[model samples]
Target chain A: MPKHILRLIILFVIVIGLFLVARQFLIPESFGEYGHYRANSIEENANHDIKYVDRAECAECHDDIAALKQGGPHKNINCQTCHGPGNLHIEDPTPENIVKETEREFCGRCHNKNAARAKLIKQIDINEHNIESKCIECHNPHEPWN
Target chain B: MELNKKNKKTRRDFLKLSSAIAGSVAFYSMFKPIESVANRKTDVTEREHWYGFGFDIEKCIGCGLCAKACKIENDVPREPFFFRTWVEQYTIKNGHIIKDENVIVESPNGGIDGFTQSVPDKEIFKSFFVPKTCNHCYKAPCVQVCPVGATFETPDGVVLVDDSYCVGCGYCIQACPYGARYLHPEKKTADKCTFCYHRLKKGLAPACVDVCPTGARMYGDLDDKEGPLVQFIKNHTCRVLKPHLNTKPKLFYNALNEEVR
Candidate 1:
């Protein structure tokens, strides 16, 4: 072989060897264990804390309220939907940890007159319907119709 | 002269043989059955879990509780533009034929606050709410476009992004046909719904499904033949968003109108 060609071949081999060595250090240990991603990432993502408690957990303690809600249109709504996340409250069992929204705007979120809202959902113009009073006073949140 | 000629002939033959051998080796390597690193590691037939999601458009009440619950559960950005999930209100104007111009779609605050009807009742012919989220496609464009291999699909068929590995080049965000991925403002990485994989791992429903005021949203294992998701699909003519895109979206919608995108 020509002297120049031999030198070129030697340089190419060294460059390729350096690249392979650098790749070993740069690439994650679990990079190819699963698909193209790092396998440990799956476990890291699954380790997130559970923030929202199931409704069945609430019903265990508040069966009376659950029974009241079951007989009404709100039966399908989860207790935590309006009350907010109850994971902490479930552990501590404190009334202050959970919300009890009684404001008209809170109820109006779903019920207030909106053209886009489903017709099946009974909507009212908040300003026109029983002005200057909370919705819970006239309409029970657990059983609004009754 | 004869000896010199014979030596030249031998040299030419050696060159030809060497060239032929090198060419064959290159051709063989090109067609070799090398294992694809991108393909799922698990055997599809033996997969213990393959999750799917479905929703009934008729059952959705436009209350936006599901949208609210998703934000609170997932810690998605409070900004209107950065949502892991959202609700869009579609209104078809009265006396107007269904067309791109006639249909009005709006999602204010990603419907975290309930929607207010923009189109007057007299002018509106029909309206419905469509809750949107990551479709978790079987052939995900986001996963395919992630140059760093940061985004991938799990064995259970949920697409997720590894924030640590992401360079945040925004290729995956742009590649998504469903407009599902968003760049996280704080993390500066591509973020989207994981199908609530963390919650799913703990044997719980996704936050949106958990808080739906009407039984509009549902989640179940596609592997389970008797699962509610399978039964619902069998019973109803469920449609996926942008079926022609060939994304193979796991999110199914029942009573999906022709007007919805």
Candidate 2:
């Protein structure tokens, strides 16, 4: 064969070989192992400390509150909605860590008057709907009507 | 005579060498697409569940409970601008008198706080809240545009970001028509709703669905013919956002108004 053609063949082989070698190193160790993404990503995402303990977790200890909340308007609301995430409180069992938001403004988040809201759903103007007292004073958070 | 024979031999050898090179290049080119096909055919027997989501506009009360739950559940940034899921309030007041007049759509702070009315009650004819989230498109432009394959869809139809591999080019964010993605200022990677993948893996509902006061949102296996989601789709008139784009979004909206765009 011609010397130039032989040399060109040698160069092509070397370049392609380098690309194959680089691909081995460049690609992630777990790439395309599970799905289109790296397999480790599933584990990485799972590793995040779960902050919101579902209502069942709260029911384990606070069954009285759970019973009260059942079938009520706020039954759908998770326990952590008013009280903060219960993970720390569940782990430590401390009053300070688990919040008790009895403030009127806290209740006003959903209850406050908004013209955009549906007429059928209950809402209130905090100023008119008992401005002098906290929401808990008139209504129990667990079973508000009672 | 020997010199002539030598010249012919060399010419024949050169032809063989050139043909060999062309054959090798052609073989390599042929395998390129096949390799991608092999990548796509990775084992998917483990993920039996295929998820799809639905929203009932009639049920949503613009309370923003879902948005708040998502932020806390996903550890999204506390900034008002960031949201994995949000609610948009569409108010059409005196809509009959005027064309698209007194129509207001707003999601202040991603509706983290419940929406307040901008137009007066007297002028308003009708209003409804439309919750928005990542559609998890089957032909997701975000996944297609990712330079590093950082954004990808799982076997079970969830679009997720491999944060470890992401180069944060912001291409995926721009590719999304529904504006579902945003760059996390702290993580420096594109962030959006995973449909709460972590929670789903743990056999829990997405945070938004978990805290929905009115059962306005539903998530379930689309493959399950008997599932409530499929039944709901069959019974109710549903539409996806921006069907004209042909993204094949999985988020189905019931009672979606034309003005929602």
Candidate 3:
């Protein structure tokens, strides 16, 4: 190929490549809206594995509290994130997953991260907060905004 | 028989022509977009899905019912910064800024009762409410400027964001001249009032439609003859928010007592 022709071909390819790479920066993720509002991927639990019921599932008995949670922000998040999942608790809503102290541990799992780069946040002194405070103190696990 | 010199062209001639083309290209790149924006017009020109809402400035009592209900339905954050929808209360006296109805804040519920006391100095003081929400412009600037198609007008004409798709870069947020869109804090996605599309799918009205204490906020198809908007337009000499821009916002404000001149 001629020298000028070869150089022209290389320049065209470079410009087109630039457009392609810049495109990724232009588009945002598609799965952000109504994210956890839909459903979570669940795996089967062994019979011995204990679980706590979803807030909505538990509403069959605790209607008042569940009703209040409906208006709160964290309404879509699974109960397991706070109380733990209820795959094994189909028969019983109460278990170690439903413990009163689980709130501190669950939030601590993320907030207690050593790095400041954490996007999600829940700040409570596990020792001090757990002694008296809990996750519900600032946020309702069932409803983050509430 | 005249021997013609080879056809001659000077370098200056070529340079001037090239410079003119380059200058035109440079100038065109800057102001051409304005013309393109003009010719592009808005999707509302088709009179299709521009969801124009009207708030009677006089009828609005400043009650924040719309905001509160929207927050619950869409889970909008109530913190100091982000706002999907808002209201601007204006009280104009002879086109003068009277009553300082400027809330300049994003509140779902403007906290006004939509009723004002009888002002004795009616000329000096008259109060009115104007609730602002996503205009759902036919040519949605948010959608156009969105680096991602995260914000788009649905086929039905209501503008919506596929939160699942939004990257929360806030390009749409900044592009909106009307400042309707915002990035959610936790979900980290762009969000705005959807006109409660989830309800519309069920053949029910939007949450704001259901909760507005007064019929201040109204929604209807601008194209349908049987739609209230058609009749509303026929009866009322209404004004659209910033119609000069020709965004063709579906949201129309009825009896907009005072719009920026």
- After superposition, candidate 2 runs with Cα above 4 Å error: A2-8, A34-36, B1-39, B42-46, B95-98
Candidate 1 Cα deviation (angstroms), residue A2: 7.1
Residue B53 CA error for candidate 1 (Å)? 1.2
TM-score of 1: 0.90
| Stretches of model 3 off by over 4 angstroms after superposition | A1-146, B1-51, B92-124, B259-261
* Model 2: lDDT of residue B117: 70
Higher-ranked by lDDT: 1 or 2: 1
Tens digit per residue, CA lDDT, model 1, A1-146 = 67999999999999999999999999998997877899889898998988898779998999999999989998888888889889889999988999898998788878888766657888898878998899999898988897
Chain B TM per candidate, please? 0.90, 0.88, 0.70
Residue B134, model 2: Cα distance from true site in angstroms? 0.7
Give the deviation of candidate 2 from the true structure as CA RMSD.
3.3
10 residues in a row with least lDDT, candidate 3 chain A: A37-46
lDDT of each: 0.87, 0.84, 0.56
lDDT tens readout by residue for model 3, A1-146: 57999999999999999999997675443322322111110110011122222235657766776767677754543333333334445565556535343455445533432211112344444556556766667766556664
Encode model 2's per-residue lDDT on A3-73: one tens digit a residue: 99999999999999999999999988888776556877867776666666765898888888898898687
Tens digits of per-residue lDDT for model 1 on B56-162? Answer: 88877777888888888889888888888888988888775646777889999988888777887798888888988999999988998889999999888889999
Candidates 2 and 3 compared by DockQ, better number:
2
